[model samples]
Target chain A: MSEKLYSISVEVNGVARSAHVPARLSLVDWLRDDLRLTGTHVGCEHGICGACSIMLDGEPVRSCLMYAVQADGHRVTTVEGLANPDGSMSVLQDSFCKCHAMQCGYCTPGMLIAAKGLLEANRHPSDTEIRAAIGGNLCRCTGYQQIVDAIHDAARRMASGAK
Target chain B: MKSAPFEYLRADSIASACEALRREGDSAKIIAGGQSLVPIMAMRLVRPSLLVDINEIAALKFIAVERDAVRIGACTRQALVERDDALASRVPLLRQALAWVGHVQTRNRGTLGGSIVHADPCAELPLAAQVLGAKMVLRSSSGARTLAAEEFFTGPMVTATDSSECLEEVHWPVWSEPRTGCAFTEIANRHGDFAMVSAACQLALDGEGRCVRAAFGLGGVGQTPLAFPRLAARLLGTKLDEAVVKSVAQDAAAQTEPGSDLFATADYRRHLAGVLAARVIRAAQEKAGGGK
Candidate 1:
């Protein structure tokens, strides 16, 4: 049976968006299907994969595990929110490209968001901490070493004030 | 994989949440972190007609050190527990157990209270709480009450929590002893996957470096996280000699009636539990400085 619908108002990437969603509608679905912000990927319907990762109230969470209503009045940042207002890549995004960390690029958005969460908390995480931070997000390609390097490089660049 | 139709109500306070639960009775389910509830809903394992989301209740999200105990609000996220300094120094077993609950993202959204209430036999935090002598606070519309860890879990996914009751907080008694150490160890196929067998142990040593008290709890081995006081008694007031530790580990293995699953057979689990228990208990004893 089609679930009953609920109205939700959320701030996505600094934009206020409103939508009518089914009670079963995941926040990821509302962002992709309704708002047309398709940057968030859906790798696993369950919480195992981080393709649907997003920053909820400044902490990265699996959007697939959260209902759309849970995002009401909360700040959500997807990969699309990574660019500057003038559309320049975030230091993290540029680092990923410079390091050629993306092979399939399917897991880039989640990897970037996960890295963003980590780099915000720790400007200089050890190799083990960097690996542990992104352990939740699976990357089938790039051997993951490049992603680790990208995060480290970005952290160093950010700390060095290299714009 | 969609959840069935249900009315959503965000509770603003504990009284309101309990009132909502009382109003909806068994027809409604409480959602804290939604990590456990959302997946179970998508899988159609449970279909409640109403969902009382308690995310807005600020009172149920705290980690405080009371005079006699450390009080953790039930809605406190598992990630918070993993990073909490007070918990690390005060309740290492609980802190270590928090790391194995799920992945970083799941832990970011999952709550310690939710894990306990979910009552999964393999959940690490519950077993850790059991071994540490933690108490659970259960609130009803009319009033509130508390239960020891053993009294909290009556069966698999079954708690003494009634439809009208909501879990408010968990209290862990603080240890003032200088020579006490705890260890949390689990065996899982993947880092974030459910455990095949998990165990937590806490050891306290007297001034003479003899074991004064020992508490061991095992998960994924029974209908609940089983506590082994009989085994702990064997080592109390005695030095943790290899033979004594081995005997206690053997007793722990024998005590577990671990069921066979797709991951591990009951026999294999018994063996793993013995090895891990022996290893962790020795480590904990050493950390407690139990040897002269």
Candidate 2:
């Protein structure tokens, strides 16, 4: 017989989404495959890469490490949710573009989520704090200097009342 | 890579979790934070027939500070433990070691009991737990029992906790001494990577800067984290001079049986064990001695 399925209802990007998933269905797969929110990339299906990071109840965590059933009653925010209400890029994303933070862009979504998570709690993070925040995320390109610069610039912009 | 399919059971109560574990026996696995478990599962290194999720069990998630000990429930997130100032005041080594844990994202979900039970020999929390001589409470449908950290950790990725048992909580002894100081440090390729060698030291000093009570340990150089109570006793009545600290750290490192891997040779890990153990011990001593 096939594996049993469990139903879960998660609030994704502020919208309540429900699905029937197998016990082994990872949260990242549910977001990308079933929900069609492909912004969250999958890299190194294990927890190391952090490419599948998402905010669970406002705290960033590795979605690949969690099964979809584990997120049944939780609120999840993917990279797609980081955009402005008018669908424009958020300041952090804008800063990333302004700094050319991404090369091939594979690691950008997770990077944005990690940086956003850091900024929400720490309004003005130091360079060391920014590096530590994105330490789990691995980008073979950009050497991480640009990503750190973008996050540093975003913090400055946000502090100066830039929407 | 993907995990092998399994039956998912979310236990609402600790007792129910124990019952489920007892029923499934060897074929079942308890998933708390899934930080360590999921990675292995995705690699297909572990494929349990039943996956018991204890994350939602409210009884398994708590941090209670008692008169001489701090009891942390099994599912308490590492981030919560890292951020809790009061708990840190009671059990200072916990936060010191947690700083070197995976990262914000993983720490946000990883649980203390999970890390200790998963029991990677080089894990930061397990090394801290070893140095602090923490007590782990294991529960099954039959009953609950406690084991000391040294006894609980048998080998790499192994614990005294059996398949039928659920780790309910961990009790960390809180040193009430006024001059108690603790420190934890590790050498890893990356900030979040597993350490090549890790050291933890917690020492209490009297007003005269003489060691009264001390505990120190090293990880990544042994089957399980190794604590040196007898060697630490040699520091009693001393001011923790460089000679004694170096001697104790070297002696402790000599007893370890580190394995050679791609990252570090056994000899190099042994060498680092001595260096790091001495570093942390001095740091802890300086803190207790008020930097004198």
Candidate 3:
């Protein structure tokens, strides 16, 4: 039997888009497969690992655990939305590159999204806060020190208004 | 692992949600926050025919302090409760316990009702609710009813709420007495992980620095959050000194019947339960400014 589909309209990465998706289609799958926004990777899919993290209504949440239909009429910010409007590397991405925060790069997208969510609310975060922000997003590479350092560096750059 | 195909219905109000649930009966499940339900669905542990999304029900998302009690709307996000300064100050134990519920991302999407309904024995929220003597409001197409935390939670992953009923809100009686203090502590393999054994205590001290009231709740040590009124009675009218605390802890360990699990042996959990009970009670006493 053909699965039923639901019509969902979501504002994704600042773009208003709509799609007909299976009711079971997760938000992450809709973004990556249907919308062709592959930056959001799926790791555990069970709300752990945080690789499928995305900003839902300005708050970071596990997209894999949310159905695409549940996100209808909502605003979603994927990792692709973290860059500047002009498409240049954002400060956080730049700091991650400079700090050598990734090795396999699988977890980088979720980490960046998580950091962006945190920075939006907290302009200046302490080391503990940085650690707590990325606590859910696991990175097997860089030993987490460089990731923390990158976030710290990004916070400093953002605070200095260096943009 | 994708969930089995299911119909999705967005609920704009609690009445509509209950109506849908009543019509669909066992075939329908309510999804708030989708933190716990989605995970179980993905694993194929539950395959309901319909998922009633209650996230848009704005009326079910609030934290209100009325009179001497705090009423938390079922859909209020865990992160919102975690950061609410007023709630933290009023029900300090809840704030401390919330920190141990998953992570910031999970808490951002998880709801108070979801955690309470999920009723994981290791969950901190249920234990905290039990310790606070919280009451859960259940609504259906028929009408509404209330159940105490002790009565609401029947067993692990089980609740007294029927399929036609939606948990509306949870009411926690605020500890407003002078020098009242509370504490929640657990032993988890990692931060934000499910506890192997957890303990929560709320204490009130009289003007003479004697224990007036004490309540204790233990998690991960039983099928449901265990409360020991007899053990709590032992500390009443006495100074919560080290010796008295030790005896109470021993009684708690002996009273609980924690089963063996892969994470820890039953004896180990029992031991930790006692140690945690003592430590948390002492910590609560210290917070109340009554500890020696």
Give the Cα lDDT of each candidate: 0.88, 0.93, 0.92
Model-by-model DockQ, in order: 0.69, 0.91, 0.85
What TM-score number comes out for model 3?
0.98
Model 2 lDDT tens row, B1-292: 8999899999999888899988888999999999999999999999999999999999988999999999999899999999999998889899989889999999999999999999999999999889889999999999999999989999999998989999999999999899999899999998888888999999999988889999999988888988999999998888898899989989998999999988889999999999998999999987776445
Maximum-DockQ candidate: 2
Q: Per-prediction TM-score, chain A only? A: 0.96, 0.98, 0.97
| Evaluation by DockQ, superior candidate among 1 and 3 | 3
* Candidate numbers, best lDDT first, in rank order: 2, 3, 1
True contacts kept of 3: 0.79
Tens-place lDDT digits, model 1, residues A60-89: 999999999988889999999988789999
Tell me the tens digit of each residue's lDDT in model 3 across A1-163.
Answer: 9988889899998899988988899999999998899999989989889999999999999999899999999999999998899999999999999999999999999999889989989999999999999999988877999999999999999999967
Docking class of 2: high
What class would a CAPRI assessor give candidate 3's docking?
high
Q: Name the top lDDT candidate.
A: 2
The backbone clash count of each candidate, in order, is 0, 0, 0
What residue runs in model 2 are displaced by over 4 Å at the alpha carbon?
none
* lDDT by residue for model 1 (B91-156), tens: 777777876778777888999899999998888888987888889999998999999999998888
Lowest lDDT 10-residue stretch of candidate 2 chain B: B283-292
Give the per-residue Cα lDDT of candidate 3 at B121. 92
Q: Candidate 2 DockQ score?
A: 0.91
Model 3: per-residue lDDT, tens digit, B82-120? Answer: 999988888888898998899889999999999999999
